[model samples]
Target: MPDTLYDALIARVRSSTKARVVVEAAALTGGLIDRGLIRSVVDLDRGEVDAIFDELTRGRVLQAVGKNRWRFHHELLREVAAELSPPSVQRRLHIRIADALVAGAADGTPEWPQVAHHYEKAQRFDEAASAYQKASINARQRGALIESQNHLARALENVERLPASHARDLHEVDIRLERGFLSSTATGHASAEAAAEFERCLQLISDEPGLALYATFSGLWSYYATRGDLRRATQLVEALRLRLADMPDWYRAATDAVFGSLAVFRGEFDSARAILEAAALAVESLDSAEIEGAWFAPNDPVAGMYTFVGFTRFIQGDLAGAEESFTKMERRCQTLPFPHGPFTLCYGHTIESLIRTEAGQTDRAAQLLGDVAAIGQQAGFDEWVMIAASAGANTSSRSPVAGGARDPAALEEHIQNLTVVVEAWRAAELISFLCWYDAALAQTLLAAGRKEEARDRVDLALQMAQETDWHIYDAELLRIRAQTHDCADAVEADLRAALELARRQGALVFELRAAADAFRWGGEPHRAELLAVLDRFPAGQDWPDLARLRSLVG
Candidate 1:
């Protein structure tokens, strides 16, 4: 019945070829047409075109949206009218309409989606891909990362349909690189999906030297680093150094930041501090606008570089230095582009909060946690949300362990929730902080007096750290491991090892922590050793670890 009614409408316009042209124009352009678009495609004068549209509207086939525009009264009528034209004619009309729209773009920026749509319908894949890419960029500028990704996906899909050639391969590489960056921003740098995109780009990116290096560093090196594979990460750093040596000063600085982070992961605190500080200084000398275009990573390079510097300082017990670095990092975040800016801020806040909590500055920690949660929620970053929630679990007042409140069931529930979240992160390949999370979980378990479970968790964390050569948290983990053992001999051996490792790493904070744990566990036997580590801190500093150590000895 719908088809019969549509055919009657079409038959009414059949006597006038120009009127038929108007129906096809309305049908082809998404069931809507203005006088300009109709006049562009048809030979009728503007007045005649207006008359035809008015007649169509009066006949109930088209509805007037305004004085100059008309649309099909029903979608079914538009579909039937669109099909009335032969495929060849339809393709021609699509191209003509697309070209007219491009010509009519008053602001010089064509409506990319509409232009791409018409070109795609015309089987003009090249134009379609380019327009789609523009659309993707427009979406990205608006902070709609997911929408940007969809547009890029469409661009890639359309570009792939074109014949295979070197140019096509390069085009695909460009699209994939953009997609990889978006994936890294939306999910995580170490996510499997982001890795896959860069891996594919690496295969096709040989001709583009800059892009090849980016793919290798961002894809392969990042994957290994996050998964605790520091050996591979070191290898990649060496490769990056040689490739980057002659490039430029900025490249050298970027490489320094990368190597510095690797050093931090390996527990080489002193060297990591120097390298990261030098990199930060180099970046700090540049204007934000200069860094924005030159620094070639998904996130703000300076912010990330400073974050590692902050960690290095914190571990080395340079509390003031660490706070300064974190403040700098947060300040850098404000100038960054969308998604990257927010993500970097969230990440910096989360890590800073962890440090604050450890320093026993609960009020500052709470404020940072609030910042992290707000940024994560505003940016629609699920991983950030999970990470912030997980970080807060142990510190929340209801938890029996880290929190002052002692509800065993509440602590157990927080532990269970944290386990699920961290494991989910593991499943997603967001393993950059897996060891830290595991150790934290173990500490909470020990506080709850579940020694066996604590030991089990500590063992797994240690294994992961050893396997990946990620030793930044080894001293703390060892301290926790020592607590889990019931045998005095075993506990003494672990504590001694933890102290030695912390001292060698120049990780004064960890050394103090291990010393406190030792003094508490070994009583009088460990008192002298604990006092020696305590003297390393400046007198009268309000570090929670120091206060705890003082109370124990006095």
Candidate 2:
């Protein structure tokens, strides 16, 4: 036999009875020499254990680190000693050690890595998978996202070793759902990998509609929403509604929350408000027992419901209501165990920054946008960074009438930044965001007094909006078109079209803007029309657009 320290240790353990017992016990307990444990294992007194340690230390096999603590001089020696036992004996030892560790763990939650190792050594694949899964959950709770992902992969590897069955399929789907959620949280965008995982889950859960509904809400919705495929998202919503009466309480609540968000994206503020309110109430009423067995109930749909409602209220010129809803969303996210699930805090902050910018809190808006921009950049989320940059551009480009002087250099910088954002969106094929960014760019150009360039930008934005059927920004684009026109009749025609579209879409903020523009260009008759519309909204006196309109009228 080849001579090595490990070989020598093994040979010594095999030759001496005391050395064999001490080495076997040490190997069983993961190579740590517990003196009292050794005495108990070998049935030796304390003095005998000290004699055994002295002999092992003199032979360069064990080293004394502290009182009652000793370890093999080389870990490889311990491994070799562990292998000296027969295969059957080794497995039984692994089981015994694993049981002891489980019994000693606090709250029945063992140190997962050690538990996983022992279970694997004992050839218990299913138990190892469960241990790894627990490890992943523990890592996630500690905010070690990447480590959690690795643990999940290990769990899946063990899961694949199990025989095929309904339970096995369900376990696989659950793992995939968690993987998808984690992927989205880490990158701040829905990944194709996550979409594939969700698709796999759907295939596996075809017969279980309740689980399928959860998969659709958690996976399909995220995929279509992030891609800006509003038509597909709408179709999915319709399909879910067809089965609404059959869905469980949690599923119904989540579906309505998603539907409300889609409605907000489509500029159907009235429908969004009603649907979101129902969703919020439904989710709030869910009991812990009802959701105990859910595989992917990490996100509180109620928080998302409030967020969409807040966004809708902001667009409808209900600033106070929007602030209240956003505050609720913020508080809910803060209280959640894993708050950065579906809708992240950065997303909430972005909307809040936009509201502040519109409410004349430019400094506060800038600070909020800066915070999100840093977070986005750190996460490598281009879309989030782009949102922050776009909002920053808008905040920086405030005109003299808005209490800030226009800087030509700042306007040009905004155009450049927005150009980059537009190109990035185009590359991603995010048509909705691309069109909105185009409109934002045109607004910057208009503020810079570059009428011809502004007209070109707005025209492109309108064309893209039409091509994609993304009418959410149609009113805003039409208003910009009105500003680009030199002729009074062309300006009036565009303003009237904008006002009608905004009114039909329930976009009160855009309608107010169009009405103000109509009064500025169409003279006495248009002014009369503006006052008539303003007369219906007495509570809007504090709104930025309405406040400006009142000053102009006076």
Candidate 3:
């Protein structure tokens, strides 16, 4: 925790280029090791600590050699203590700056920092430049514009730094997207390739224990998300969850948020909420997510647990509440420029509609749905889905539907917000979510009296479900199946299967939705049966069906 300890770690890391170790130590000490030019974090007792302090005042570490009073031969001190004093452990601090210079620097920038003759220093500019470029590319891909810009500036600071080499092209693409230009598949491909390259760089630093894990987490997130392999993504996330078990409590929130997202995708909103409870209430960027190594609580610094708590306040019908989150998100997350996913915004909007609908403000709900449709139209695909019993859903509730026919003006306003799904998918792009889209299409067609088309859409939705390993979300598609049914027995069987599936997965949310469909398709007897099952489902949800649930409850 001493200033000397902090400086020692920085100094050693400068020579060694193994920053992960320093960061690991920082993580271990709960960040007490930062702030000062402390040479290193030592577990010295009273007498020994005092002796080191006395020596520090006289510039004992390096004053004779013109080195700063803060500088020290950390490795040498450990040797001396080992021979003549109380027991101690010391590390050959390897600075990542050294490695970055070796790997990336072409020339300039190292002179100012003044690495001693004993330090084998190369140029420092290139590594920072290269890291900036790589980070910029990743940040842009994940839509972190500010973060990308910050890194771009760092890379550019190196006078000899080449024009954004590895991810140069991507650098521009992110800029274009920020300016609202349409991004192409070629651009997406470039982004993915850039990501893979960054991953390779990270793996090269495998000697740094905790850093390697984050690089691993990054590679896996992009890979499975791109492939739509939620199953594999879920598994890897679970592994990270277990891996971070002994980590500091501060690190727990970020890891859990990622894990909770998979749970949401897997239709586990309950689990997702539980994990998100930490982040949702607190309002800030989860920097703790990247802090690596065997985690120990950082000393005395207040983290954002309080802020996350404020962020999570919402009711089922609060569209205003939902919008409030977006406001908070924009405010709290301003500095976290790119490589982060748009999961928060997209998910926030999705829940906004649900909450608005649940609050009986169907018009506002419809507007929200239209807003998302526009995002999908422009962004290529709105590639988000609520899947598991884990974590995920949107909310903040208020209702215009509390009155009989709803507030006429609000209803009109909501209707005005609807986006005509003139095309089969967003803009001209193929749908990323076939099952959900197809199922939704079938319902629209059925309502519009296009029964034949409805039946076909439903059939396709079901077929897609049968082929995918993500059989869990297959329930969304199953709603279409009942409409395809002509016989009582067929309808009954489908309803029964869906009900069973919902219960098996703890998909009470979706189950409640399906109960409404069952009432429509199952007729009097099945409606009675489904309603009874629906009784166990939580009463509130941000959807039109909340009305049905309300009616049933009454």
Best-matching candidate per TM-score? 2
Estimate candidate 3's alpha-carbon lDDT, on a 0 to 1 scale.
Answer: 0.42
lDDT of 2 by residue, 307-384 (tens): 777777777767788878878887876765542532355677776776676666678779988988886766545556
Residue 231 C-alpha lDDT in model 2: 79
In candidate 3, stretches whose alpha carbon ends up further than 4 angstroms from where it belongs are 1-191, 198-208, 268-343, 354-362, 366-434, 449-452, 466-468, 471-473, 520-524, 527-534, 537-544, 552-554
Per-residue lDDT of 125 in model 2: 70
Q: What C-alpha root-mean-square deviation, in Å, does candidate 3 show against the real structure?
A: 16.4
Per-residue C-alpha lDDT of model 3 across residues 1-554, encoded as one tens digit per residue: 45665455445435432332333323222212221222233333445434444444353332222332222334444332223211221122223323333333346433212121102122344444454555556555665455555655555455233354534433332222222211212133113443444454344443343434543453444345334566666776666666665555554565565555555545454455566665554414434444322111110011222122212223212223445555654443333322122323343444454444444555665665555555434434434321100011111112322333334353443222221231323343322243444554455444444567667766755554454333435565565566666787877677677766765655564565567667766556656656666566443434445555647535
TM-scores of all candidate predictions against the true structure: 0.84, 0.86, 0.50
Superposed by TM-score, candidate 1 places the C-alpha of residue 221 at a distance from the truth, in angstroms, of 3.8
Residue 216, model 2, lDDT: 49
Better of 1 and 3 by TM-score: 1
Candidate 2, clashing residue pairs? none
* lDDT by residue (tens digit), candidate 1, 178-226: 7877777777656667778777876886635563564446446666787
Per-model root-mean-square deviation over C-alphas: 3.9, 4.0, 16.4
* CA error at residue 126 for candidate 1, angstroms: 2.1
TM-score of 1: 0.84
